[model samples]
Target chain A: MAWDLSSDRPIFIQIIERIQMDIVSGKYNAGEKLPSVRELAAEAAVNPNTMQKALSELERTGLVYTQRTSGRYITEDEAMIAGLREKLAREKVTEFLESMKRLNYQPDEIVPMITEREETQ
Target chain B: MTSLLECRNLTKRYENKTALSDINLDLTAGHIVGLLGPNGSGKTTLIKLINGLLYPTEGSVRVKGHEIGVESKRVVSYLPDHMFLNDNRKIKYILSYFSDFFEDFDSAKAYEMLGRLGIDSEAKLRTLSKGTKEKVHLILAMSRRAELYVLDEPIAGVDPAARDYILNTILTGYNEQATILISTHLITDIENILDEVIFLQHGQIRLHATVDEIRQREGKSVDTLFREVFRC
Candidate 1:
């Protein structure tokens, strides 16, 4: 996942979002060992402290686990991963629908197109 | 569960004037605390007391459940505002000294970080630029996995770009379980990163609270409050 340093949002939050995207894109497979804090900081050109903050947030959200003296690993629970994916997907759909409504698009005009796209997928 | 640093009604007097009076502090682990104060407010004095470099005329100072002494010195890592490393020694030699003194020094990590900065270990300390020298000092302080890190003015006088680098090093390099106490007047730059703050004014702790709690209660950033509280 790409980490952009110039974003106005906090760096730690951006790091968390990038990791979430990686999970969604399968860049980090279940139970895969993530990079160490120092490695990630070097890779991203961010402070090691910022990287630690991101990792701490991921741990808080149950997306990663630390094995003492070993390292942090991606959660292997497929159900948990799927649950997060579905939750994010729902949020996106809700946002899209809200945008359409604001643009004066009726449910009859947009829902069928969405349904057709899902059917094709 | 023992406190890393403690003070009880600590007081210090300088030349017939009180620098600090009745200042009590109890700090625990897993906290990156900010010690905020204006000039001559005694923030430095308080830290000196904790590091065993200065003795309080009244009350007491303790580290790791023992009064300030040799054992406390062993567990506490201090980075004073001024340069402490010998100007003639090579960076690698200093690293060796640190390793010998602190049993928990992570040599591999330290070397890896220096490599990232493109810093060679053989260079003499006196030959390096000021910013580079500051980084070297910070690297040494952070390489040790000490129980408490007392950094005084860690980034006060560096260039903006280098300032970010130094702050990042501290953030990423230190052990998460250890307590870090940073004393500085640059509250805005570090306000976002702190777990809590101990606002010092006229040699006393005026406010101490979690970052979130402070924002909630004051409806303002700690920097804003600091300016208002210490406004002339």
Candidate 2:
């Protein structure tokens, strides 16, 4: 997948978000072996050190684990992935709601607008 | 374990003009530093001083704790802004030439990159396009396992796609212990890979900070900050 990095935020944070999205979306399945830091950095067109930092942060959150010799792997906990998916969805929805509110749409109008947009699509 | 590069009271002068004045900087190992500035900002002068091509008028530059000389030259791989290779030579010949001159040059890696880029080893350099020639130059320079890689305008003339390839090549080629000091005005193109940046204005050091710090504090890219700081 293409990495769309903005200049406004720290790149390592973006790396974390991208990897988290991949894990939650099942692009990287639970218990599957993740690519090496160098491989991921090259793919993302970022520094390996930055990628390593991101992976370490993921490990801290229990989303990834490292084996001393073999390398890093995605967490085998299915519930953690589900939780992350829900969290990401909620954050996106909150953002959408805020934007709709700014557009002067009432909370009661949002559900109908969503259904109307989905049907038109 | 001295700093990878250190400059003390570094100043450069030619005749009556001062190119760089009273500069002090230290670059440690493992950093990909961006030496950024506009035209005649002494970016080239600083690079030339580090490469030992031009001596400083009143100061010193040390690489791995040694002054810029034979010892430092051995460890510093420099890619000057201008074309340094002979156009009459073929790609293979240039590879051999690099291998002969630089003890750290890895012929195998150079050949691998050439093949990956679909550059014929037997083709003469004169026949290649401008961008291809620059790629060849980059391949040769990065093939060296030097302690410090000083690149001047490595991405200047290339298209966006080629720029990405060039940046990736630099990123993957260097060893972890080595440091890369890339001097360029194309701040956005190189900003993502940079660990730190040193901005120069009017032959003086303007700012030096890590990329993350700048992004966090300024809420913008290096490109935007540079434009704001140096706006005419």
Angstrom error of the Cα, residue A17, model 2: value is 1.0
- Model 2 residue A72 CA deviation (Å) reads 1.2
lDDT of 1 by residue, B53-113 (tens): 8889899888877998888878888888889889999999989998997887888878877
* Chain B TM-score list for all models: 0.93, 0.97
Local lDDT at B124 for model 1: 95
lDDT of 2 by residue, B103-221 (tens): 99999999988887888999999999998898898888899999999999987877787788778877777798899999998888878888889999989999999888898899988
Give the runs in model 2 whose Cα sits over 4 Å from its true position. Answer: A118-121
- Cα DockQ of the candidate 2 complex: 0.70
lDDT computed for candidate 1: 0.81
How far out, in Å, is residue B137 in model 2?
1.5
Model 1, native contacts kept: 0.06
**Each prediction's whole-model lDDT (CA):** 0.81, 0.90
DockQ of each: 0.12, 0.70
Q: List residue ranges in candidate 1 displaced over 4 A.
A: A1-121, B159-162
Tell me how far the alpha carbon of residue B28 in candidate 2 is from the true structure, in angstroms, after superposition.
1.5
